[model samples]
Target: MSVGLGLPIAAPEQLPTWARRADASPFSTLALLDRLVYANPEPLVTLATLVGTTERVRLQTEVLLAPLHRTALLAKQAATLDLLSGGRFTLGIGIGGRPDDYLAAGIEQRTRGRRLDDQMARMRRMWNGQPLGDEVGPVGPAPARPGGPEVLFGGFVPAVMNRVARWGDGFLGAALPPAHMDRLFRDVEAAWAKQGRAGRPRLVAQVNAALGPEETVAAARREAHAYYHPSPFADHVAEGILTTPRAVRDAVAAFRAIGADEVMLYCWAPDPEQVERMADAVF
Candidate 1:
């Protein structure tokens, strides 16, 4: 399985250097997290900048909240990124759990799931170059990939399976243990079979790691807790962070053994050196 790195939502000024480091590292992809009411750079914007800076690593949104934006616009943005990135992009989307983000985006919280479903359907049509009837031909600058960048769906419930079956190319499993990941993958595979999808959907998984001295690892735990503790799985997330090289090594092996196509190790600390630490541990 290929190993990838997730660029943390840190100071914007530091991102260029971080992106360069991740690109140069022995990693397969550079992923980003999305949030409207948080500290992260807008995933697409940050990714656009990296399109010119990084030559090899694939880019992903990690999980862009689709319900917050207009469907066609999001589709266009994704296609543009794919075009500019030489087809090295993946659109990972989900109906995120933060109601505050929805409120901030002027979206209705209760209808997000339905909204995401509709958005995915629309995006696929847009990517396929279908006409909108009122528009002047299909959306232009067709995706770098024929059908558009691969779409990966992420969420915490079985409802997500429906979207995966319809539009996604894979399942973007969250930061979870190998046992839980096993169950999640099985469910997604079952969903794909039930929907009669052509082949097995790709299986990608994520885990948080803070590889450095005690101080950096501690900060990683704090950041992980601050971001995840608002949910019901706070303790599980907090406890899952890999603090040592051995921890990172073990976690990667565990996820790969469970059949993950790629396992992304998200850095919780904002330090650029964290990339090297991770590379040292994994590469």
Candidate 2:
């Protein structure tokens, strides 16, 4: 199994150093989280800037909120990024829970699931060169990879499995214990087969991590806490933050044992050295 890393949410300015360091490392991919009501960078735009700076390592939005953006525009931006990045981009999406994002986007949170389902269809068609109308013609700049970048869905809900079956690309698991991830992945596999899909879905698991001095670890813990504030699950998320080399190694091994294709560690400590530190532990 391969391992990946997530850029820090608290520091956007460090991404250039962090992305370059990760690119030169053995990590298979680099990821970023999504937040509309928090102090975080927009994943797509942030990743787009790295396309020219890095040479290896795939780029991903660990889980970008899909319901808030215009489908056609998102399709264009993703295709452009994929093309520019030499087809090294993975689009991992989720129906976000933050009501503040919907409030900001002027979208209805209750309708997010339905909206994503419809948007997925339209975005796929747009990527495959389907025009909006006879008069509108096909969207400009065809995808670098045929049929566009691979799409992965993320969540703990049963309905998320349906999305995987319908799309048949992959599933991006949240930071949960191994048992929870195994159960969720098993359900996803069954749903995919029930839908008569040709092959199994790609399974990628994610976990939050921090490796540094005690002060740095505590600071990262506080960052994670603030990010998940008000949600009861915030405490649960905090508990899962892997703080040492053994913890990171054990997490990767657990996911690998369950047949995961990749383990994405969301490194919360913001430092360029953390990249080397994580790579040494994982690779």
Candidate 3:
């Protein structure tokens, strides 16, 4: 199985250690709609440092909410990061869940789905070196990758799945249940087949996992709860999804059985050292 690490955007204090860690590949989780709010203003600089320091590890935006940001600017940032990272970049994107984010950005939350589609289309055009109408010409210093970094779409709803089938190169499902995953994979595969696409769609799922003696499992559940409780998956967690490593592993194995190509573990420890410790047990 291919392993990838998630960088904490919610906790900027952890980033320095996360960056300095030599054992794990760095994957930035860009869930914040506004860069000024959640990310350092100088993200490219941080990404460049990670690339220069690490030998085998790659850098990725675990996700950037597309609807809240301007398309052309987002394309430029992604392209620059890809160029700086020597093509070791993957553009993971999603339509964010918080309506407040769209409100703060002065974007209409009701129109976000359509906006995301248009934005994605525009981003692709910009990446292809096509001159947009007016003076907004081709982006300077093309991405190191020929076509640009791979675009991965994340979401679990039907609209999101349709978007993935139509435009995205991959699908990322967060905190998914295995049975639910089976249905999702079938839908995506069927869509791909209808479109006469040849290869299987890249499928990835992220789950919270904590490994330790039995005494620590409760603490792990609380950590996992902090993330899932206020989200759509809140009901699932209430149904006992994040209680233990065995529960998490069983869910992952079920996804693998149903053809999920990758599984990303979201570690919820307060300390980077604890995250590394958990990684050692799970990996």
Highest TM-score scorer = 2
Per-residue lDDT of candidate 3, residues 1-283 (tens digit)? 4545555444555555665562353332322112423323234445655666555556655566777778888888888878876777777788777765677788888988899999878777788888777876786557888766777888777777777777777787775577877787888777767767768778877665555544445554664555554787664563453445566556657778888777666554435554555444445
Choose 1 or 2, whichever is better by TM-score: 2
User: What overall lDDT, based on C-alpha atoms, would model 1 receive against the true structure?
Assistant: 0.87
What count of clashes does model 1 give? 0
lDDT of 2 at 198: 90
Reference-based lDDT, residue 117, model 1: 83
Each candidate: what lDDT? Answer: 0.87, 0.89, 0.64
Model 3 misplaced regions, further than 4 Å: 22-49, 212-249
> Which sequence of candidate numbers ranks them by lDDT, best first?
2, 1, 3
TM-score-based ranking? 2, 1, 3
User: How well is each residue in 73-102 modelled by candidate 1, as lDDT tens digits?
Assistant: 898999999999999999999988888999
Model 2, CA-based lDDT: 0.89
lDDT of 2 by residue, 2-50 (tens): 8999888788998988888888989989898888888899999999998
TM-score of each: 0.95, 0.97, 0.81
Clash number for each model: 0, 0, 0
Clashing pairs in 1: none
- lDDT: worst 10-residue window of model 1: 132-141
